[model samples]
Target: MSTPARKRRGRRAYIAGALAEEQVARYYELRGLQLAHRRWRGSRGEIDLVLRDGDAVVFVEVKSAPTHARAAESLRPAQVRRIMMTAQEFLGREPRGELTEMRLDVALVDGQGVIEIVENALSDF
Candidate 1:
């Protein structure tokens, strides 16, 4: 059980995360990427954003923190693994899965609510 203050903080965090996702989605949309899904969930975990980038499918993991570095650092290996698994599940259900190129991206949201998208961010991982 959580105290009232803790509960409030948790709710605040959830709201912040959701808003961050929306901002990131809009940022991608402005770049000509069409949003395929938001908060797509599977048995493994949830993908923050799924977008169609031309002939490629992009899976974006959004992180929000006090700073851009902190936001980027928040994506841990375990979380990446979970996101990857969920992405695989998402692709499996798509009819054009094999035909489309896949990409993993990260969107970092800073304290000022600025979004910085890093494409192929997980490629070397």
Candidate 2:
């Protein structure tokens, strides 16, 4: 049983997430990366943004919260695994397949809409 208030909150979160993704995409684009896909979904999971930097593929996970640190902390280990799996699925479509060079980045958006990009945020994964 979903209440009206709950639905409204869910809608608001969705909108905020969408906006954060958009902001992150623009941030990368300004830095010379070309947007390849937005909200790319695979059997494993969804990748918020996929960009191309030369021949390298950059998979970005966008997070939004009251603070940048909170946004960064929101990405759990389970989600990291899912993102990695999804990234591999996405790479399967590339010309080099799984051999394609790639990196995972986390983009954190604060309440005021400021963006902070953590490059290679999941290098150890």
Maximum-lDDT candidate: 2
Compared with the true structure, model 1 gives a TM-score of 0.93
Please write out the lDDT profile of model 2 over residues 2-36, one tens digit for every residue. Answer: 79989999999999999999989998999999999
- Please tell me which predicted candidate would have the highest TM-score against the true structure: 2
Error of 2 at 80 (Å): 0.6
Clashes of each: 0, 0
lDDT of 2: 0.95
Error of 1 at 69 (Å): 0.5
Task: Output the worst ten-in-a-row residue range by lDDT, candidate 2.
Answer: 116-125
The collision pairs in model 2 are: none
In model 2, where do residues sit more than 4 Å from their true spots?
none
TM-scores of the candidates in the order shown: 0.93, 0.95
Score each candidate by Cα lDDT: 0.91, 0.95
Q: Model 1, 1-125: lDDT tens per residue?
A: 56998999999999999999999999999989999999999999999999998878999999999999999988999998898889888888888864558999999999999888898898767
